[model samples]
Target: MMQATTAVRGRTERAGGKRAEWTGGLSRRSFPAGFVFGTAASAYQVEGMALKDGRGPNICDAFVKIPGEIANNATADVTVDEYHRYKEDVNIMKSMGFDAYRFSISAGTGKVNWKGVAYYNRFINYMVKIGITPYANLYHYDLPVALEVQYGGLLNRKVVEAFADYADFCFKTFGDRVKNWFSFNEPRVVAALGYDDGRFAPGRCTKCKAGNSATEPYIVAHHLILSHAAAVKRYRQKYQHTQKGRIGILLDFVWYEGLTNSTADQAAAQRSRDFHIGWFLHPIIYGEYPKTLQVIVKERLPKFTPDEVHMDMLQSVIPQLKIQNMICKLVVFLIVRIMNFLIPLASPGAADERNGVLIGNRANSDWLYIVPWGLYKAVTYVKEKYGNPTMFLSENGMDDPGNVTITQGVHDTTRVAYYRSYITKLKEAIDDGANCIGYFAWSLLDNFEWKLGYTSRFGLVYVDFRTLRRYPKMSAHWFRDVVTSKN
Candidate 1:
């Protein structure tokens, strides 16, 4: 029944017919059978029962305390209150017919917090009862405050032991129910935003009061990769067999198209990609950093142990970005490579790297530009580079300003359009033989967006921060029909 409906939708899309009126003629049937569709969320962003019973503060809790860190100084202390209302949220997702639910474990004190475990157990049980597969990520930017103050988070090799111990607890506690495990989500972001720019939790950077962006990002990333390997090794050694689960890491990927087709510009674009996604991924896949990075960054980049170079059960990702005008950023990265011996910058999101021109429509965020084609290039690049590993389009969505009224909010035609364009390109990539298995929108609710705080709305369900009520936006209904479609 689904295949037939999908075929009809495909024909209508090709014919430019009535199906276009509803959802651009796309639906879950539009992709391969068994491809998962869901929404993604992180612990700090959604679960707001911070410090309730036996909980501990995370680095984010500390970062937001410093004035002016988050937009409007907003905090996720109660953003969306998912900790208290996950049952309701799970119900919504089940009714929407999404195949999976992607969320993270909350950060806690060094010891296992049964209070945290109890909440997840109930949440996972509800999801299982309703047939929603749980994709649990072990970490998502929220390092326990103790970890940072005690041994220096991610920077010191000691973090590898601490993280593995934490991972062991999670695997032993939840692995029976959760089959899909992600060791970390965007570890590069954790290193870059936290250590290199001091823009995130435990903020540290060259310009900050006490950081060495020149050396710390690489050190942090190296430790993160090692930590991930340790977790994967432990899982494989003990639980993976009886538990029947697969583990992987999520890396943020961005495509860099040359500014003008000039050879230098083109070379710069390649460097941008190598510096960004290639920085962490290359090491795990081939046991070393990208050759370009090793040559440029030299000793700043760390080497992996022979034991640290094993294959993860899977290679998953959240989303891919593209930046075209990184012409100037190329020079900056080169300079940083000389000064710090690290891949200092990422490819353009929409060509703002060193003020190069942009290719497509701009969004509210200065760094974001709509470039659907970039998604195709990103997944395809990963396919070619990493021997065609299975991937999850774990996150892909745009945000509108939060100040938009409820009436104007659900009319999110722009966001709907963004999803349409990006997903279509993603489909194109899959058809071209990329090994993508699923795609999740960035969020389920307009909870706190890190850095931007409540200033951005990237949710398909419009959230009224005042009432904490969730109203399905146009995109939500569109996604519903796509998932539950029977033609």
Candidate 2:
């Protein structure tokens, strides 16, 4: 087990007039040696030039077309123009002392998008030229429009072989230099939101005039697990010997807590997790879905074949609020079972306040609340329940209003405090024997957030959307100290 320490606190005064260092007993010395620290971004979310240079329309390109979908009627056709300005973004990381940067391939979903190929090659070469390391993700919710138009995307088993082909190509093309890779980011969100509520690309659901919310989510999720395992199998068999790198999948899970000390609420909390994280993690790690899911979901869930079971890399995204477990279970039940034809997606968690009691600080998004201790619970739960696989707090960060002025955006004390509290609890999880190797803040720069579009900013560094300029917020400096500081 690792041990926690009383290290220097991150900077908070840069945002607010109050110049108080974080009182939490956490600092640079709290983490283990060789621990990685970095910032993360996605392709569809950050990379601009959606239709340029032979690239096809991704699901994001299609989803944004519907009226009144994204906030402010926004589109990511030119989101911070990362495709044209990756060098500038890398420079920001180099200056802030981040050890790595995680970005996904936004090109052809299956076949070669030569434009995307050239762009990623340029971006990776630049990152390697500088001191920063590259961590590439294979998928981040932007499915190829071609597949969805032809075979209904993840809903069909055909996507399994298609995704494998894509993964194989990526490993062969970029695996030599880009050593760290994740197969998918937030597969849970992709399953629930896209197939259940119709909120994302390739949108389909009972409520949206198409899709079977009850069965489609499970099918999509099962195929995603298979796809991940297939990619890992190919990599281990073919590339692992030469590339000498690790591969994994990223999952997002919010911590659950009962509203009161009642048995009902307590059971609700446990059941909610069995359906949420256990829905995917249990299958990948244990080679089967949780028993609770088997009993509750019945034949709606798919089974893995004997030859199809290959345990892949598991990366748990550690953020979001501590949900009211009773409410959480009831809501998931409604969406998962009762409201089969009236499907609704799961938001961040239960209501921000339960029965007139606020959980913690609220982020700009209604679904997220500031609950630092939830970080400890999330990591510890995965550690104890899932055999403590080598883990990374793959994605953890909160958002602020995007309409704020550049001056106000940079002086973001709320964001600074959010990072300080969450990271402290993260240290506590590490101390309690969780095998967490690294932490990646949700984003390095303010880019177009999916659904919320440009309305919610979740970046350590603020990006001037108009000029595409980068400014390190107070949290960025503190992260630099946390990651690079050696005492």
Candidate 3:
């Protein structure tokens, strides 16, 4: 107890401060010229018109309807109401000196939501008008509910066609203005959580009435990769010549470090990474899943057909297109079995703390622990392992508990420390020759946080859920200063 108390106090002294120690020496000028700074968000999390504005029901819409599925039986049906207040949100982003805004397009096909289309068009135009570059992502775990009900959603090959069509439509409509495109964000999470554990939307698992945890996650991941490749092929063959935009997929990666220097622990950490990021990236970059996965899963893992191999191989032909693997957050893991595979435990398994000392500081989220050095290790690992493809530090931020009062929320000194330390390590990675070009914070406002509902606040700006008002937090001001600094 004494040791734990001492550790907590030591961390508070280092991290809890009026200004984070790392911020004093860091500024916009500290990074290489042309580095992008922005905030990212998905449509389902922030856009509140789930049933209105001509939007169709997504898998989340259906999943949240189930009793006891989400926190407090909450739904995003009218969560933050960004659907009605985007102009205000975008203006807030502009005022923060952000150079780009990475937002997702959640348009559903089959009847076409023209009103939804018009809303996004206006949103994108206003950002462009105000000198904020737009980085658009096609899907972020919000699969059309109809697709799931009709043919098993991402598990079936049909989803590849559906997703390709959706990507094509987005390119045709918004490609001219949106130069940066991502086909899907964190498909790994979609597969592992939604299929493996039945934790996320379209929930399925072995124990559930539907889903085979062992096989479905692999099938969903295979289909997602095909969908990404198909979209890239379409953009390259049809749109790139005229539209002149770059396209990629977003992956969420957590840096897994061994508990000790023992050989078993080291191998366990590497295997965890292989199963996590490598499940998606290995096929995209090298045309197959990692060898570790191949040997371990053997017969259970789905085989890629020759045609599918060709589709996967297509991404490697385009050198300009890069992977936008978001360093969403990092974790320290001990070798553990999960979902019939030997991978890093998704939930907090291997304690973040060893010997009564926490790894860094714990964030409000159960899964997130603030370990800035983990960011450096994650980026450096991508460089060393994956041929150092051009990358983006896509989504990185800590969250506050949702119940904090606005006055308490705005004084976010800990979040400011989180950003300063994380970005400082990111610069260290860049200096170490990681081909990273951009960094996007996890979010711009406190909106619906998926299964956690509105209980976890990961935004730099505070949203008063009562009035749906926006108030910039200290972290937001810190970002503005860092971004606009001439020194």
Candidate 4:
């Protein structure tokens, strides 16, 4: 267990006579020695030149073509132009005193994109040169269009082999420089949003033109778990010996709170959690799906073969388990909010408010709520429920409306408070015996947010969409001060 000093309040006055109040006393010293502090962004979300530099199209490229699929019918063809401006981004991170930068390796299907590979080579080399450690994620919702066209993507077991090949390529190629690797980012989101709700790339659902909502989500999830295990196994066997790198999977969890303290509502909340995170984490850690899921989903859930069961059991001993827990909101009646993934029996009742009270202040995104203590609950829950595995608060931040001016965007006091509060809860969780090792803010720069596109801004540095210039917001400054503070 680790202990840190209690956070104290302080205020800073901004240029326009606005006051930004935060628990400014919380500094890097609040964490254990060697703990990591950094910012995180996905390749599809931040990398521009989606089709340039020999880059092949991804499922998102094809999905954004449908009318009104993304906000403003927008595409990530040139988001922040990270493909061209990674050096500038890394400089910003270094300037802010970040110890690491978590970015994804955006590989396309079919042939190897040498230009894309060269670009990441330069990117990783520059990060190393600038003293910024690179944490590379292998997948982040952007499956190759070829794989989807070939065999239904994650729906078919074939994807497991393809993904393992891709992961092996990444490990053999970039694992030398990137010390930390995550096999997948939010696999649950991939399975649920893509198959269950039809809201994301390769969209398919019960009512959509293609896909079986009930069965496909489970099948996709099962394959994803297998894919992660295969990747880990390959890394451990081939790369881990010589490259000396660490690998794990990233999971997204929304801390679910019952609308009421009644036994039924509490049970409903538990069900939401089991369906949400337990779907993946349980299989990886315990070699099977949660009993709640097995009972509820019944035969719809795929059974792991004996060999696959042994593979899952092997994964349980992984050193690091990166969890991306954000959106500390209240849920009711086990809405699960995973669309058709849950049958009608689960009931739909996800609300940030109950009996005329909000869970906390709502953010610009429909799902994000500013319930800070929910972070503590989430981390503590993972620590207690999941055997206290080594964890990282991989992604946690809120967004402001994207339609603001550069001046308005840079003056992001709300974002400052959001980080201050949420990070404080994270410290409390750590202090209370959660073996969390690091924290990464959701994003370093605003780029093409999926589904919502540019309508939501979740970045510490504000980027002018037209000019592609970067300006660190108030939150960034706060982080620099805290992270570099000698106190």
Candidate 5:
């Protein structure tokens, strides 16, 4: 969890203040030249043409239909209508002086929705025409519903191949113009919220069946990793020379700290890191899961065949007792086993390191703590452990309750502070030799926030779902200054 300071809270409290007044004193520091600063949105979250443009049905399209699945019975049927209004949206980006526009695309195996391809091509062209580099994400939780129905979405290995095919299509279609590519956005959310908690689309499992073989989040994550790797391999082999772009995975991670200095709390904090960020990151960087995770999965997850182990070593390598190691290893293993039974909290944190706390609490709320320091630590950890591959702050923002109203304009001072604190930390990381190249705020505007739906708003711009109006919040001005000032 990212810390909400008085500055941030004060901004949120003045949700109706004049945008200029609120943004007047915010100073922006100069960032490295060509350092990208942009806002992001996804197809399912903002685009309303769910069925148009020959767009195949996505998991989100189907999942929202399930009773009690979405809040206020709201579906992203008309979201911000970005599909039809992308040109206008690009104008908005250009007017805001945005150098890059990051958006997600809808693509699946043989189910290549050519209409979607055409739509994205036009969108890409518009961004290029407007002089904004387009950063396209292949998937952002909007898995094609057809794939989910035929195969269990990310749980099945077949989905990995399908996603690769989709990536190949994207690379071939838009690679000439678009350079930056994200294989998946916040995949851990897909595995944990969609597969394990069943709170989001394709809601299948819940806490009651928590840790069940059928509900293994790690399995879903395993396939997602394979899918990401396959896309990267495809891009490197086929598109790199012609496209002149780089490929990387975007992970949502935060800083975690022990609630106290007790050994039990420290172990719990480490476990939180292992389960949240390490689950997806280890494979991408280390080519495997953390050793701690392997032990937990072995104890709690179902068994797999030798062939499965060979093919999917990333997720299937649950630790076995036969391996001989130091006494410390055994002690750590026992401690984790005990913690698993005693503590049931795990969540990702904000991208910006504020205090030194982990953020999300998909399971239990008490265990979630905001540790801004952890953001710095997490970057250092990735740099040290993953050999410092090109990295960026993929997703980072403050979540606010939506009922709060802005009489004048959307204040969102909390979000502004969140941005400042995180960006400040990000600068420190870059100064420390972390090769971070870009920063994409978690969202451009508030749209469907998965299970939280219209309840949690993390957007710099406010979206009035009823009227489909887009209003830039106070944070938007803050971010605009940051971008214009190159801070």
Candidate 6:
């Protein structure tokens, strides 16, 4: 466990003679020896050149053009131009004493266009040359427009093969030096917001339009799980001997607080848990879908033929029903009941376990959140349920308005507070026996924030989209101190 220190307090005097006292929470002691500190950025979010260097168009490129898709009518066409300025980005990371740097590949869906291959090669090589471990992610919500045009992205099983091929390309190309690999970034957001909520790219599908009546998202998730497993299998069989690396999936979760201690609210919170976090984590760690998902799929979701199943499953007996049209309904109900009995228990005490953390978005926006303590709870939950493998923060940060300006610099005190509170919880999680190996801040610079475009800022360093100048915010300096002091 990292030691704790006194919170730092300071005062700032503005040019207008207004004075403000800044008091931060307890400063964490230096991170345990060899603890990793890093920053993250995604393709499409930070890598501009949406149409340059033979880069094929991704869904984001098209999604942003739709009227009212992005908040500020901004596109990532020239976002920091990381495609051309990766060396500079590496310099920024090095200057901040970052030990690891993670970035997402923008290969449209599964096709690895030469331009993406070259761009990622440059970025990974630059990180290697600078002595920073490069942790690369296969997908970060930038599905290829071609795939969506052909088969509605994850809704089609062909995407699983395509994504596996893309992962193979990445492992073959960069696996020599870049060993740490993430299959996807916050797939829950993709499942809920994109397919179920209809707020994100590949906008509202039939499932969300039908509200809970449609089961496309679960089916899509089925495909995604197969894709991830295929990628992991490929990495293990082919790349592990040479790279000697590990592969894992990245997921986002929040701590659920029952509205009250009543059994009904507790049950509701438990359902939320199985629906949200367990949806993704269960399959990857336990080799099966969450029970709640199985129930929902069987009871409320639409069904596909045997051809629709992404992976092979054990054959089950189906009894003939007496009613003519009720056959499908009866079959589904039986399947749901069978699943309720057959789905493996998550753990002995998972349902009753509560980490005493409250998760809520800091800002009212869908992207921003203030669930600092949830970080700890998530780690502990994973530890208890999945057997604590060497884990990383994967994603953590708050979003701010990108249009703000400051003379002294980009003073994001709110972001600083967010990081401080989250880090403190992270420290507590580590002390509680979660094998948290590292931390990765969500983003490196302000860029196109998917559907929100440049409306939200989540970067430790600020990027001037007009001038393409990178300026470190107050959080950047604070992070530098944290890294330098090994906290």
Taking all chains together, the TM-score of candidate 2 against the true structure is 0.88
Reference-based lDDT, residue 211, model 5: 38
TM-score of each: 0.88, 0.88, 0.91, 0.91, 0.79, 0.80
Candidate 4 minimal-lDDT segment of 10 residues? 1-10
Model 1 is weakest, by summed lDDT over 10 consecutive residues, at 325-334
Q: List the residue pairs that clash in candidate 3.
A: none
- lDDT string for model 4 (314-367, tens) is 444342344322111111111112221224222346766767677778788878
List, residue by residue over 293-395, the lDDT tens digit for candidate 2: 7887788888877666532332211111012100010001101110111112343244445667677767887677787777787788888886676777877
Query: How would you encode candidate 6's per-residue C-alpha lDDT over 216-275 as one tens digit per residue?
Result: 567676777677767766776688767777676777665555655777666666666677
For model 6, where is the 10-residue window of minimal lDDT?
Answer: 329-338
Clashing residue pairs for model 1: 297-341, 323-348, 325-351
Pairs that collide, model 4: none
Worst 10 residues of 3 by lDDT: 331-340
Query: Model 6: residues >4 Å from true position, as ranges?
Result: 1-29, 108-112, 207-213, 299-361, 364-367
Give Cα-based local distance difference scores for all models.
0.75, 0.74, 0.78, 0.79, 0.64, 0.64
Please report how far candidate 1 places residue 13 from its true position, in Å: 14
Task: After the best TM-score superposition of candidate 5, give how far the Cα of residue 181 lies from its true spot, in angstroms.
Answer: 0.9
Candidate 3: residue 287 lDDT (0-100): 76
